[model samples]
Target: MYKRILLPTDGSELSHACVTAGLEFAQQLQAEVVAVYVAGNYQYPLYVDILPPNGPTEEEYQAAMQTLAESYLQPVREAAAAAGLACQQVIQFNDSTAKEIVHTAQEYACDLIFMGSHGRSGLGQFILGSVTTKVLSLCLIPVLVHRIKHH
Candidate 1:
């Protein structure tokens, strides 16, 4: 039984399925749901050369990121509200998605994390690996991965 469930969404269809599954688990356990969106930080060394000297100072860039965060997590928030579960949203800019997710779960004291398997494979898997796999390897809390079949 979980008291708090952490759900991460990336605005993808599979992420939506993960949110739905998380909601069902939260409903069954009478648990609160926390939705986290981890934004990619552009400060990495490889990207340093590509960024302007000041970096992302444009209002449009900031606004776009903000809008993205809100829109992406909005459905999850609504689902939790409809289910009568206490819900909160978090946005973090980080270089490592898996690290951020694991950290957020710990910070929120979540008993469980429900996520989607993005199902990357072949060259893509070799190049990018999987965030779910990395999180599963690093996390301490219980992880329930909803495998969303890729079309």
Candidate 2:
């Protein structure tokens, strides 16, 4: 029923597995795929009084993030090509990964978001932060979280 699907990845093996499954699902639905990598924005060091002489400049940070994004999204691109599925790739920077994911979905008019969840619960989720939980709470579109049991 969905026309477009958004897949967000952090380059982990689990996320890549999710990407493969999500692409398969998109192929079944005859939908286009949007692969997005949201990197955290560069933050200046907190010590204003004692500034470090050697820190990444904003431009340097952007370049590094871009390189990292390409690394993370390369598999997605290759998978989409192999599946002969139409794919759009996006790179975004934001403090909140979940918000960026939802925004990307809305911006691309994606009908569904298919992403991996680490299955953190209760205290673990609260301490480590759960993007899946945040996305489920904030997103208006459908979210299908793929979880793989880890040994």
The most accurate candidate by lDDT is 2
TM-scores of the candidates are 0.82, 0.89
Report every candidate's CA lDDT: 0.83, 0.88
Task: List, residue by residue over 17-87, the lDDT tens digit for candidate 1.
Answer: 87898898899999999999998764444555576675565465556777899999998998889989899
- Residue-level lDDT tens digits of model 2 in 40-89: 99898897666677988889999999999999998898889899889999
lDDT of 1: 0.83
- Looking at model 2, the pairs that clash are none
Query: Model 1: runs farther than 4 Å from truth?
Result: 43-55, 58-60, 120-129, 149-151
* Candidate no. 1 TM-score: 0.82
- Give one clash count per candidate, in the order shown: 0, 0
